[model samples]
Target: MDERLTIASAKANLEKGSLSAEALVGSCLETIKQGDKDVHAFLELSQTAIEEARAIDARRNAGEQLGPLAGIPVAMKDNMLVQGWESTAGALILEGHKGSYNATVTQRLKDAGAILIGRTNMDDAAMGSSTETSHWGPTKNPWDMTKVPGGSSGGSAAAVAAGFVPVSLGSDTGGSIRQPASLCGVVGLKPTYGRVSRYGLIALASSLDQIGPFAHTVEDAALMLQVIEGKDPRDATSVDLTQTTIPELIEKDVRGLKLGLPKEYFLEGMDPAVKKTVLEAVDRLVAAGAQIEEISLPHAEYALAAYYIIQPAEASSNLGRFDGLRYGYHSSGQNLKETYERTRGEGFGREVKRRIMLGSYTLSAGYYDAYYRKALKVRSLIKKDFDDALKIVDAIVTPTSPSVAWGLGEKFNDPLTMYLSDIYTITANLATIPAMSIPCGFVNDLPVGLQIMGKAFDEYTLFRIGATYQSLTDWYLRSPDTFST
Candidate 1:
């Protein structure tokens, strides 16, 4: 069994009878069993995975038509609800909680004949930039166990990088998906805010959160997005989008495309190797007949500050429902207030508590206009920055992260430094535009990602650029030696 199989290749192999769904799922399960102990990417395994794969194989044997992802094994971030599966968002507060119903994406994948494999680990309550804050434990980078896999979608990215699954789903509130994918050396896409439904996802920052895919190749990521993108009645924020052929759209040539290199994105403190590697990727596109031009998003410098304020303010409001009286962990007290205090104090992790306080403080009566309102205004300006810059260029390119993967505990003591790791990615979320991270090259043996940001709902352009770059380089095809056969 080929452990490195992608969704597109797996589907073709399954159709040709050269690969059985059972064998494919079994290979992934076996790989998880053998390597997951060291990587800790998965929080829980789906016991029924093999059974589901066999059913798909049986249906195919009977000559029934299958969906695009038929028989393909995929892992979902723990935040996504999957009926009958534990959906803890890496918080002890929701420990042992099972989804009563499927998230829209989960149901959609099911309908597409994809086999749900398991749930991956994440930062507790999706508050941290590194997986170190996970209540269960941090998910180590597959490339180097000592290094941290970027979070809160670290586990999802690492799963694809380690070849445990061809694709996985992750929610990006503020670079949660793209930053980790950059660190893990895989492909991660955060679609336009309303492009996909968020009905079943455990809310982190509702306005900023967007669910997307992690895959080894741009085409695989596009394939997964194609299966999941669309409006759902359950989610009011979801847009009623006309589905396009993403796979075919991504195959278009990059010639005549105008790519932008935002001057503001090249920060002073960025690692020299990362900058060089990203520019090399741009050169490859230039060689393919694409044009590069320097552009400016002046407000980009303030994006991280604004995002920190807005995200937490929304997070505090959204997490109010996780009190002990609900379905999750409970801590009884002499009074109702004390009960709420004890339940949250004991159930929530340190980082979660800190953010809740920060958010609450910022949203307080006197501080609302001073902080939250100002941040919202800054967000608008940042969006305008992207809107203006994108009018002249097809897409904006930059480094996904300022640096490669860091040691597990390196940034744990300093929250400000940890937040800076997402400086490049948060602006896209703030702008509500589609962004992607594709492996471009390496820095000191660790992977570097070339980021592409596109206009709202213009994911096709980003994918086309990514696919073209991927065609000219084999960076996406490389896997960690620890997991490689």
Candidate 2:
């Protein structure tokens, strides 16, 4: 069994009868068993993974038609609801909680014949930038066990990087998916805000959160997105994509395409090695006949500030339902008020509580206009910045994260420094545009990602540029040494 098999290759092999779904799923399960003890990427393994694989194999043997992802094994972030399985969201509040319904993406993947492997760990309530805040434990980078694999989607990214699965699902609210993918040296895509349905996902910031795919290659990521992208009646934010089809990303020609390099992204404080590697990638695109132009996003500097205010405000509202009156951890108290306070106090983590407090304060009387409303205005300006830039350039390119993977505990004590980690990725989320992180080069032996951003619902352009870049480089082909053993 080839442990490095990608979705496309795996599908081809399965179709040719050269690979059985059982063998493929078994290889991934074995890999997880051998490596997960040290990596801690998975929070729970799916009991039905092998059974599902057997069902797919039986159908194939009977000559039934298969979907694009038929027999492919997939891991999902714990925040996504999968009926009959635990969906803890890495928080103590929902420990041992079982999902009663399937998330739209989960159901879509199941319909496409992909085998659901397990749920991976993440930041508690998907609030932190690193997985260190997970109640269970942090997921270590596959490249170096001492370092972090970025988050709040760290486990999803780490699983793909560790060769446990070809693809995994992750949510990005201010770079949760892209930043982790950059650190893990894999492909992560955060589709446009309304491109995919959000029903059944444990909300972080309803306005900013987006579910996407993490895979070893751009094609695999695209394939997963294709299977899951579309509107659902259950989610009002979902947009109808019946008239517009996702482009088939083939590495044909990239000539005449103009890509922007935002001046704000290249500012000081960025690691010198990361800058050099990304610039080298830009040069490679230039050599491939694409044009690189310097662009200005003046409001980009304010994106981080605006995102923090808006995201927390939305998060506070979304998380209000978990006050122990419903289904989550509950603490006993003398009265109703005390019960509410005690339940939240004990059930929530420090970071989650802090954000809730901040959010509550921002939305309070007299402060709404000064903070939340103003932040919404700033968000508009940030979106306008991308709109203006896209009018001239086909897409925007930048480093996925300012630096490569850092030591597990390096930024735990300093929240401000940790916030800066998503400086490059938050802008795209704020703008509600599609963006992707593809492995471009290495810095001190750690992988660096080149992020490609496109206009709303324009994932095809981002995928085209990413696929083209991957075709000219072997960075995505490399894997952690632990996998080879």
Candidate 3:
């Protein structure tokens, strides 16, 4: 029942009869019942979670073999399809839409004996950096209720931060997972693009979006990633690459490893406290025997601009299928065109509509060459920057976000500033590399994250660096005051 119990510890206890799956599941559900009202993390709680856990217990008692995450309760983002479960992606247009088939990740979790406890809130259609844009209202930062949890994966991050679940699944298009994890003081991992299948996930930006995990420890996140990562036949983009045993790999020595501190990431305008803490964290890594060198990713400055252009362009295209003629919310009109217009106008939230409009404009006849195509070329340059840099170091290090958690609604009206929140994270997605965020230290009583991005398919290196850093500090173990009891 301990909210701080990690997946490794819980799995050990469960296997030895020291913990029952039912007790663990019940405790998580009870915690959600008692605390979710304030955090607003979950969109819906699964009615059958306890029942499923009990079945796992029965199987364990019968000497049946179990999966890696056996009996663990995991909260999934609303964007992942769970058969017969409402998967709205935090959009009103899909409010009542239930998944007819499970997303590949959802089924993978189930097969691994993970109990999907509920659907967590997110930005409407995964279009925003703050969960405040969610149709169901914002998920409060567990560390400070008045502050925003970074999003659109904020709900999943808050769920773990608030002790509602040991781990949760979230998709990062531009930093949804890492930014929220940094704000919530948890470990979030975005695996190498194509290393994990995207089949069944509600697409935000097909090429940029990736499913990852949020957990209390780097090892826990690695374990979750191991359970869900693989080449799926349903997703053509998924690669058939050899998978590394990340949990075991993280225990390897980090000495002799070279990590890059990108000159572009240490900007003049970032929060001074965050910069101080993150640099201090880098010092700890140096003390742990890792060598550090200053590096440059010159295209980093343009990552944000290119990301906005590319992500929305793809999002607008993917979201086009949600017209009233399909399996979601609809509006009646005299004609098909009017129905399409009204359905989208009345269904999507303000931010979603804004992105769709921006996307439509960029992809239009004249602007396509000027905007979207130019963004694509810039994206290639950004990827080259990372590729050229990674050839020198094992991984790239940077701040996960510019600042710590901000007050809810502070920047809701300023779309430009909101977009800036993801400046540090979008490049990983753009580069198609593996990245992770681990709690470094606190700034103004809120957590800051040190982001480590590795070469494509080199998640093992990122995990190794994260696990090494975590061992050098207790930041990951410190729970928010609200959930520390």
lDDT of 2 by residue, 1-485 (tens): 22466897788899999999999999899989999999999999999899999999999999999888899999999999999999999998998789999999999999999999999999999999889999998999998999999999999999999989999999999999999999999999999999889999999999999999999888888888888888899999999974343436355467999999998889888999999999999999999999989999999889989988998899999889887876778898999989989988998898998889989999999999999999999999999999999999999999999999999899998888999999999999999999999999888889999999998988888888888888888899888887754
Q: Can you list the residue pairs that collide in candidate 2? A: none
The digit string of per-residue lDDT tens for model 3 on 1-485 reads: 23475788789889889999999999999999999999999999999999999999999999999998899999999999999999899998997899999999999999999999999999999988889989989999999999999998999999999988999999999999999999999999998999889999999999999999999988999888888888899999998878655586676458999999999889766999899999999989888889999999998889989998999899899999999776788998999999999999999999898888899999999999999999999999999999999999999889999999999999999999999999999999999999999999999899999999999999998888999887778888888887886
Candidate 1 residue pairs in clash (backbone atoms < 3 Å): none
For model 2, how many clashes?
0
Lowest summed lDDT over 10 consecutive residues: which window, candidate 1?
243-252
TM per candidate comes to 0.98, 0.98, 0.98
Worst 10 residues of 3 by lDDT: 244-253
Global lDDT of model 1: 0.92
- Worst-scoring 10-residue span by lDDT in model 2: 242-251
TM-score (C-alpha, index-matched) for candidate 2? 0.98
Quantify all predictions' global Cα lDDT against the true fold: 0.92, 0.92, 0.92
